[model samples]
Target chain A: MDSSASPLSHPFDNAIRLTGSNGHYQGQTTAPYANMVGPFGGVLAGVMLKAVLQHPQCQGEPVALTVNFLAPVADGDFTVDAKAVRTNRSTQHWYVELSQQGQVALTATAVFATRRETWSAPQTPYPGAPRSESVPAMPKVPGLPGFFANYDLRLVRGGIAPMPQAEARLPHCSDTLLWARDNPPRPLDFPALAALSDIFFPRLFVRRQGPALIGTVSMNIIFHADANTLARQGEQYLLGEARAHRFYNGYFDQSAELWSSDGELLVTTNQVVYYKE
Target chain B: MDSSASPLSHPFDNAIRLTGSNGHYQGQTTAPYANMVGPFGGVLAGVMLKAVLQHPQCQGEPVALTVNFLAPVADGDFTVDAKAVRTNRSTQHWYVELSQQGQVALTATAVFATRRETWSAPQTPYPGAPRSESVPAMPKVPGLPGFFANYDLRLVRGGIAPMPQAEARLPHCSDTLLWARDNPPRPLDFPALAALSDIFFPRLFVRRQGPALIGTVSMNIIFHADANTLARQGEQYLLGEARAHRFYNGYFDQSAELWSSDGELLVTTNQVVYYKE
Candidate 1:
């Protein structure tokens, strides 16, 4: 991989100067570099959610972030800035924005719950489907067109292992399994984990005939349990499956399952995809 | 039933101003209205998409539209203005926005495909599930809860229907149906259809048992066919069922089937719901 030309260093990220480039700091720009294409409207709202969670003012626990796509982000260098609109001991609200070259592309204002260190609580999650331990190690599918390169993937059962053929839809009852991981794993922080929203690809079962004609806009993750447990498990591969999908017009929504190899169904994902096939 | 004090207006129709709000017109204010709370944020983008298609200097062949939510809309009203960014006989690019209100609360800049009207074409939609030929429609569930009174609804499903039982896992087979209608049979025009983006409720199926929940902020719609045909079908009822949902961090993407009363699979709806249920 060429160092300077990698997709990781998007045009937007590089435009951030150390002190300022119209209205941002260099440090702030690199934060979203982790996930280049943001949630929707071409703004880094998806990444912004994570950053909001990591804010210092939150007191309870940051669990969810919902963004309303207000506009199509103009193409060019931009900035994402957030201000704590409201705050207290337990929750905080933030107003954010994406300005392209200087014009606003998308704007988001949200609330975040804080983590309280003094609270003691019982821990358990709904009995989810057993987690599968047979997930093979993740493969390095770098920007290789098939895997989107951000996550390491291992095909356990239903991968279009061969690049071209995985495009066919499996029978309605037949499902596929695959393992995915983020590089340089750390304590599954909200922003980092949310960034992995692009990881799971169970919908490969929804086969398309011609070219690989599919892409995602944004995803919402429900933290059913402590995501921090991901580090202790010492295992990375997560089993995931697309549960349902409906195609109307030129779009389809695919619901999926994300499970830890240890039999723990860790997360459920639902995404709308636009595929030109 | 009380005429003026009624929350009975059709939200989809051109809403009459209760008080002459400056946000409603142009010149002095470029914004549309207090878009954050009103249904306008999502609807504005939809209207812009439609306006783009109807721009002069091009054939008015209907091109589908899909708007992905990026962030929460800003408070205050904004303007949704559209113009042909690029135009030719075959394809045109249209730019639209809900602007000048706390920055663009919503915007859409896209291309509209136009071809010379060809010989009349054959039309075939799925035989939609049956419904009352002329049922007493439910009062429209205008913009989520508070924002009602702007629109009305007539459930073509006839009357108050029972909500389906909750299921941890989706049905094994892929079959879906439902019936819905906008109150006051307003003329079905592009702008009107765009306004329906606010009407499609993919979140109602999973309303929280309590108040601590968020709803769908972004929705994408793909029109498979022409607008005239869809309107000719009369106030269409929406029938949908999901394929699967991945629940992670209080967010999910649901794939669904959308059908009309005559079993005509009207359109498929793919939505990502954000909630804490």
Candidate 2:
């Protein structure tokens, strides 16, 4: 009578259920890992930051968690919430939700990390520019429909077209070339590789038509530990790249680099893009 | 004092200074001219949606805007503010801010397009795949360190490297044989050709340090107004690509593309990254 070991397998060992604990409101974990489609955007962002650190109660623990998928939760059973209006004592504030049939796909508001962790290093190095040496490669070009086709491309320099204009000025934010990799290999597990590097988007080649943009409302991340040092660069591939990208009025910004193709270096991300092509 | 009569001066007339009224936020601006980061991110997003359509007195007229830059103002001078928290009737909610010496570089929140512009055709088509056919040229690679040479890259296929125990499976995002024009061309405008196509950032490359990773916070864009119909398909090299790059547990996402040179299609973007390498 295991009832086929139901409850969607494990649902986070089924626990953290407190209805209206104190502050951050709405809570319902129940799936450690199952149904997939529905409650997994970082497990509905760890049940909205563990129901906003057990609500209003404040404290500086959960460093960060930001989400904004908006919709796409169809696997089965779910309900993860958060609502801490605001707090201080070091700092704490929450406003997250992740419902299911009842709608509300994704919405977030988290700003934790009142400090502490003391990693050190921001003596200021990322000011701007440096990473393009003749640049030109990027061309394997495949994945269309449901993407993720074992990747592994390279093209060290501008490949096709009458394309040939910018050959001098390289400051305002320029120079770029890449050589990616990720075919089959998995298990690097940094929150499932940061949920697949948050879906990769160097501003999808600029688009705009009479103006109408939407799809990402917020995002923020900052972590360190040398980001794994690319496991000593020898995994065949993992190296990612990008240095600068800035779009004004319509809003958009970028800065990237994540390597490991015998080069090591494994994590660094920054993004702030909002429609304007 | 015309500064040589202008080699492209006006970093914002000399850093805005308006006041009080703002006179209904003016009009007939040719959509802030070609737009893509010029009229100073749309004059601080039209003074934050004209202070939320003149404060809820509820009327409606904006269609889109969603910005966030954290820092990097200094085009010449600074200071721009906007406000209008929320609105009803049709929909309104604005908030714009950009500062320089004062601090807070950038931050925005907009939701315009209250419908009315009617113009259809995008039921979603332009989705093709399998185009390796020839793959050869891609060796320009010489950008990075101040504007990255203004873009003109090349990287055709992932140049093998699976040594360490045959490591292979890297392709979750990266394929850019880019070709962003207007290096010295001149006179295209539209926020300097959208700050030169939103400043290339195909995930970025070369930083190495073991597990390599850098920064990018949040970004989301979806523009496609025939963006000049692929610039008349005169085919000037464009082909930018991406898909499947969702680094969970930590934060990151991907989906990008911009093609030309016979391939047509001209703009696209999608991002979410939170570094750690």
lDDT of 1: 0.42
Decoy 2 TM-score against native: 0.27
Measured over the true interface residues after superposition, the C-alpha RMSD of each candidate is 10.1, 11.2
Expressed as tens digits, the lDDT of each residue in A159-236 for candidate 1 is: 444442243334332244565555333344444444455454424333331234444433344433344556644535
User: What TM-score results for chain B when candidate 1 is compared with the true chain B?
Assistant: 0.63
Q: Could you give candidate 2's per-residue lDDT for residues A122-236 as a string of tens digits?
A: 2112322223333343334432212223333343322222222222323232333345444344334233333334434333231121123433333443333222333443334
Off-target runs (Cα >4 Å) in candidate 2 are: A1-170, A174-217, A220-249, A256-270, A273-277, B1-238, B243-277
Model 1: CA > 4 A from native: A1-132, A137-143, A146-150, A161-176, A200-206, A213-236, A243-277, B1-11, B16-130, B134-177, B187-229, B240-257, B262-277
TM-score of model 1 vs. true structure: 0.55
DockQ of candidate 1 is: 0.08
Q: What is the C-alpha lDDT profile of model 1 across B1-277, one tens digit per residue?
A: 1123225544432232122222222212112223334444334554455445444454544343444343455433434455554344444444344445444444343434432333221122343444544534345433335333333443322121232222322323222234444444554455555454445333334322123344453344434345555666666554444332344455444445445444554443344445554
Top of the candidates by TM-score: 1
